[model samples]
Target: MTCARIPTKYGDFQLCYYTNTLDKKEHLAFYMGDVSEADDVLVRIHSECFTGDVLGSRRCDCGEQLDRSLQMIANQGAGVLVYLRQEGRGIGLLQKLRAYNLQDQGHDTVDANLLLGHGADERSYSLAARILEDIGVKSVLLMTNNPLKISALEAEGIKVNKRVPLEAPVNSDNESYLLTKVQRMDHLLQFAPPSKPIKQRAL
Candidate 1:
């Protein structure tokens, strides 16, 4: 593990980069304040999304969720945001782009992945559980809309005190994609519409 100070618009964060035995990909942890020995520390287990996160693409809500999670953690004064290198829901960039082309051709995200011979989401959280352990976070108030992420972390021995909804603004481009997540993938986004208040989900 290598640690460094990362200055972002949100605030100063201690960024730790890691190479784990679970996969060849390098993972990252960007945290603020003292998360060690903390319970109910806000956490976001984010999978990498090149288009949405970096390019600010509106095709999906990844960038918005990433930004929202960080701001939430920063405001809370103590939290961890884990960046898992699972691009495009773990299909890798090339295939993900291919899947996007399929999506453009009228297939939804899930069908696009299935057409490309991949699971709806191939990412794993064992590494995230390991990262939180290394960071000394006793338990977490996980920021996410995915219940599967909560279950996965618990399965890997990370205690989730509760779930904090990390939803993003709905837009025309991503509305269908987001709806697909709720309809097909079972992601909790009852507050997906712009008018609804952020709803909290208990673990």
Candidate 2:
């Protein structure tokens, strides 16, 4: 693992890179403060969402959640954000875009992925656990609404002291996507009426 100092709007962080042997992809962890001996350290295992995070797509709440996690961490004074390169829940960007097309044709998020011949979520948390272990994080206050994530990390032997819900306001474009997560994917998120205009442009 290699690390370098990174300055961001939230605060200064050390960006650590981990090279994956199985898939040969690189993952990153952005963190502030030492968590070597800390229990219940704030940690967010965030999967990469190119469309949402980079493009600001409103079709999913990923980007907003990422921002919220960082802000919360900054406020709390210590945290780690593990950025996994698992675009589209591990199906990669191309298939995710294909899934989006299926979604536009009247499919929910999970169904769209299934129709594309991929699991609803192909992401695994063992890599995240490895990253956390490498950085000496023992237990975490995991920032997520996905129970699967918490369980996956626990299965990988990373102790989760608590679940910190990461919620974002619904917009017209992402309402159905968020609903799909709650209903089909068993994500612990509440749905509300769209509170703002959809900022997503067609991909």
Candidate 3:
């Protein structure tokens, strides 16, 4: 459970960087604040998104979620953000871009992934759980909108004390994508009632 210190431009953080021998790929756990002392720590298990997180692409809410989690933790003055290096839902950047192309052709996010021969959600949370245990966080208030993340963490014995929903502003371009998440992915999005049907005038 011991971790090594890692120096970064953002700030120096204690990290347990290693490859899951099961997957045999690189992953990281970033420790912040007095995680061992706090009763319920703040945590964010974030997936890597190059286009949306770094490039400000509006295709998805990944970057905004990352920013929001950082601000919330900064305000709380405690927490950890486990930045899992699973780019493009673990299929990597090139495939994600190809999925984007499929999206442009009218495929929803899930469909795009399927079209590109990838699972709808290739990300996992086992590493996050291991990292949390290593850092001595007994329980946490997880910052996320995805219920699956909450479930995954809890399933792995990372006590999730609460679920903090990260709701981003919906725009025309990403509306369908969000809707697909709600309907297909079991995301906890509150759907507004349908508006009354418009009265049509005879032509």
Candidate 4:
């Protein structure tokens, strides 16, 4: 892993890059403080969301979650945020946009991905675990809504001390998308009712 200083509005972080033999993609880990040989380190395994993270699109709450995670870690004075390069849950950008078009036509996020011949979520946490190991993290207080992340990391021998829920406000634009995650994909998310009922199709 090669690391360099990344100064952000929240705080100063060391952005480390890693390349795995499993794929050609370069994954990143933005971290603060001394987590080396630390236990119960605060950590977030975030999948890449081009539309949501970069474009700040309201179609999903990924950008908000990413910002919140950074701020939370900054407040705590220590943590690791692993940014996986798994676009649209590993379907890549082109197909993700195709899925988005399907979603616009009323299909929920999961069904749209399935319609495009991809699993609802194709992300793997094996690389995340390896990154943590490389950083010498003994255990983690994982910040995430996806239980699959917890399970996948644990399965790879990364001890998870606890699961910290990362919740984002629901808006009409992304209510159905978030709801589909909670109801269909078993994500642990809590939200107040959207200000108004969305007319999106049922999951």
Most TM-score-accurate candidate: 4
Per-model clash counts, in order, read 0, 0, 0, 0
Candidate 1 regions exceeding 4 Å error are: 191-203
**Which of candidates 2 and 3 reaches a greater lDDT?**
2
lDDT for each residue of candidate 1 in 1-203, tens digit (9 for 90 to 100): 78999999989999999998878998999999999998899999999999999999999999999999999988998899999999999999999999999999999999999999999889889999999999999999999999999999999999999999987887778877987888787899864443342243211
Tens-digit lDDT string for candidate 2 (1-203) = 78999888998888998987877889899998877778989999999999999999999999999999989988888999999999999999999999999999999999999998999999988889999998899899999999999989999999999999999878889988987787788888755323533344221
lDDT for position 166 in model 3: 73
Which 10 consecutive residues of model 4 have the lowest summed lDDT? Answer: 194-203
The candidate with the higher lDDT, 1 or 3, is 1
Q: Supply candidate 2's per-residue lDDT for 80.
A: 96
Output the lDDT of residue 56, model 2: 92
TM-score of 2: 0.93
Per-prediction TM-score: 0.93, 0.93, 0.83, 0.93
Q: How displaced is residue 34 in candidate 4, in Å? A: 0.9
lDDT score at residue 96, model 1, on the 0-100 scale: 92
lDDT of 4 by residue, 1-203 (tens): 68999999998999999989999999999999989999989999999999999999999989999999999899999999999999999999999999999999989999999999999889898999999999999999999998988999999999999999888877878888887887788888764334435454332
lDDT of 3 by residue, 1-203 (tens): 35787654445557767666667666776666688856688898988888878998888878888877777776776788888888987889999999889988888888899988899999888887887787788899988878889988889998888988877777666666767787778887554422422122111
Candidate 4 is scored at a TM of 0.93
Cα shift from native, residue 76, model 1 (Å) = 0.7
What lDDT is reached at residue 162 by model 1?
97
What overall lDDT goes with each candidate model? 0.90, 0.89, 0.78, 0.91
- Angstrom error of the Cα, residue 68, model 3: value is 0.6
